[model samples]
Every structure is written in C-alpha cells, then in structure tokens.
Target: MNSHSSDKKGILRRLRRIQGQVSGLERMVEDDSYCIDVLTQISAATAALQACALALLDDHLHCCVADAVTRGGDAAREKVDEASQAIARLVRS
Candidate 1:
C-alpha cells in the first residue's frame, strides 16, 4: 500500500481552511453583509472543496488504481470501474 502522509496533511489543512471560510460566511449572513460579498465567499468555499476532492481523486488514481491496473485481473477492472463512476459524479457536480 502507498503511504499518503503528506497528502493527508495537505488535505486536512485544506479542510480546516474550508471550515473557516464557512464560519466566515455564516457570520457574514448573520451580520447582513452585502449580497455579492456573501455570494463571492460561497463561490470561494465551493471551489476550495472541489479542489480538495480532485486532489483526493488524483491520489487514488496514482496509488490504488495504478496498483490494481498493474495486477491485470478482476481487481483492475473493479478499480477502473470505481474510478470511472467517481469521475462521472465529479463531472456532474
């Protein structure tokens, strides 16, 4: 198995930042901040979340999926199928 210690740290950091963004959004709404400002922050949070998801997907492709593909068996097909479905969902989002 591959160790993604650094990847994990980066992801956790991103999540923490996203959490702070959400809190700020909440405060903005509570304080009746300008509509466009709130909307802009929301967009920023959404983009950050999507970026984090892509990073996780990239890690999965490079590690688990790559290993399964190299094995050339049922595991490979399953991993490919799994990755395809994940990609489709992300695209739909």
Candidate 2:
C-alpha cells in the first residue's frame, strides 16, 4: 500500500545490510575491537540509513505527493504539509 512499493525489495535489501552491519558492530565490541574502528562502522551504518530515508522521501514526493497535488484540493495541501513535516523530521534527525 506504499507509494514506494516498487522499491520495497531494494529498500529491504539495504536495511538487511544495515542489520548485518549492526551485528558486525556488536561482534566487534564483543571481540574488543578498537573504538575508532567500531565508530567508523557505526558512522557508515548511519549514513546508509539516512540515504535510505532520503530515497523513500524522494519516492513519496514523486508518487504520493504528485498524485495528491494532481487532485488539486484539500488533499493536495495536506499532502504537501505531510511532506514538509517529513522533511523537517529528516533534517532534525
């Protein structure tokens, strides 16, 4: 039911990779890996997640938002406001 249903598989794949990275980070801690090394991996994982969020946002704009705007009514304004809120959340995060 998502606008990005077409990208679901790819997004899930990336999330799985991020999950693996998190596991690796956990293992690194268990094995007493260097702090900087662990932090580096953490940073990489964070960036990957942010990239995924941005991609989803882009898809929402192109698909859901576009469709709502095409309708040209209260729904259009609502969709735009929703998008702005989403962007604000992303930026704040």
In candidate 2, residue 86 scores what lDDT? 95
Q: Against the unseen true structure, what C-alpha lDDT does each candidate score? A: 0.92, 0.92
Model 1: lDDT of residue 9 = 82
Query: Any idea what lDDT model 2 has?
Result: 0.92
- Model 1 RMSD in angstroms: 1.9
Q: Mind giving the per-residue lDDT tens digits that candidate 1 earns over 15-88?
A: 99999999999999999999999999999999999999899889999888888999989999999999999999
Writing each residue's lDDT as its tens digit, candidate 2 over 1-93 gives 394565888888989999999999999999999999999999999999999998788888988999999999999999999999999999999
Per-candidate TM equals: 0.92, 0.92
Query: Runs in model 1 with CA error above 4 Å?
Result: 1-6
List of clashing residue pairs for candidate 1? none
Candidate 2's C-alpha runs over 4 A off are 1-4
- The per-candidate count of clashes, in order, stands at 0, 0
